[model samples]
Target: MSVLIKSSLARKIVMALSGLFLVFFLGQHFIINITSVIAPETFNLWSHFMGYNPLVQYALQPVLIAGVIIHFVMGFVLEIQNNKARGLSYVKYKGGANASWVSRNMIISGAVILAFLGLHFYDFWLPEIAYKYIENNPEDATRYHAETVHKFEAIWRTVLYIISFALLALHLLHGFASSFQTMGINNKYSSAIKTFTKIYAIAIPLGFIFIAIYHHLNPITH
Candidate 1:
């Protein structure tokens, strides 16, 4: 394990795999979250199950957190190592001559996304933990939808969500295609894969933005 982390190639592979895993989780989360806007009852049912499921709460949640840590930490390590290896030559390097703006500034986009994740965890995860574990409150299966809607009641939060998701789109624009490349998936399907990734990069963030705006405009006023 230590030896694998020491190898640059191995580190890239690990980062790529972890990133792809998070992409899958993101898709699943989006699907569930979208239901909150369309079908409140369904959203409540699914949220209740996810919140109480031992497999998710105990096993998958920890693994997901670890994957996020590994990907971000490895990204920072690789960026630093790349900069060091480039040294003085990096000063003369013209990023635009070869790479796209999105590719060149992944670190900036990634940092924004990391900050957004912190906010997301604080808004949702911490409260959920307090409700279920620390406070030992009984589960209320029907409460999820109202809680989700209430979070978007503030315009500031809605705007921040849109901004964060915009940066997330930027991050995915390059990261998604690069993950496949890092995994050495260079076959005839590569073009199709890139096309799908581009759509996903744009669509998922837009979907999240829509969700935020939808709830903000249509608040649960009871």
Candidate 2:
């Protein structure tokens, strides 16, 4: 079991599975956030429910952190190994002519998205979890749910979120298809699967962007 964990193929498999899990989690998050655009009151209610759910928070928080670390480390390790294996430098690219630009620059987009994640945590998660919940800021905690609505109402914050979501869409465009291939799902039907995945990759991120922009333009009354 230890050997398998250390093996390259095994690492890729684990990364792929964890990545897919994160993808699903992102979908859930995006859906929840979209509620703010539709009905701020409903969104505040839902956010409060999530914030107050100790069981859900305790169970998923650590799991999410672990999955993110594992997936990122595995991806970097694989990239390094591939680079070392190809000792010869190429002046021109031969393959990937048919691949989308996002497919080729997934690492770059992923890095950007990761940086945005840090900012996101700083802007929202830290206040919600660390300051409000951990330090027990009763005032902030009380307004936590409505705080999200106000945060998105800020034009600068909403613009930043829109940019981050755009990078996320690019990252997912390639990541969705590549994760399946890494998990050994590639076959004759792989093309169809990839096409569908790309469509979803586009839609979900656009949904988040639209909501962010909408909320920014139309401030919700708290």
**TM agreement with the true structure for every prediction:** 0.94, 0.83
Which tens-of-lDDT digit does each residue in 137-162 have in candidate 1?
98799999999999999999999999
**Model 1: how large is the Cα RMSD against the reference?**
2.7
> Count of backbone clashes for each model?
0, 0
Which residue pairs clash within candidate 1? none
Q: Candidate 2: which pairs clash?
A: none
Model 2 Cα lDDT, one tens digit per residue, 44-82: 767777776777688887888888888777777766654
RMSD of each: 2.7, 3.8
Backbone clashes, candidate 2: 0
| Angstrom error at residue 79, model 2 | 1.7
What local lDDT score does residue 188 receive in model 2, on the 0 to 100 scale?
A: 95
Give the alpha-carbon lDDT of every model: 0.90, 0.75
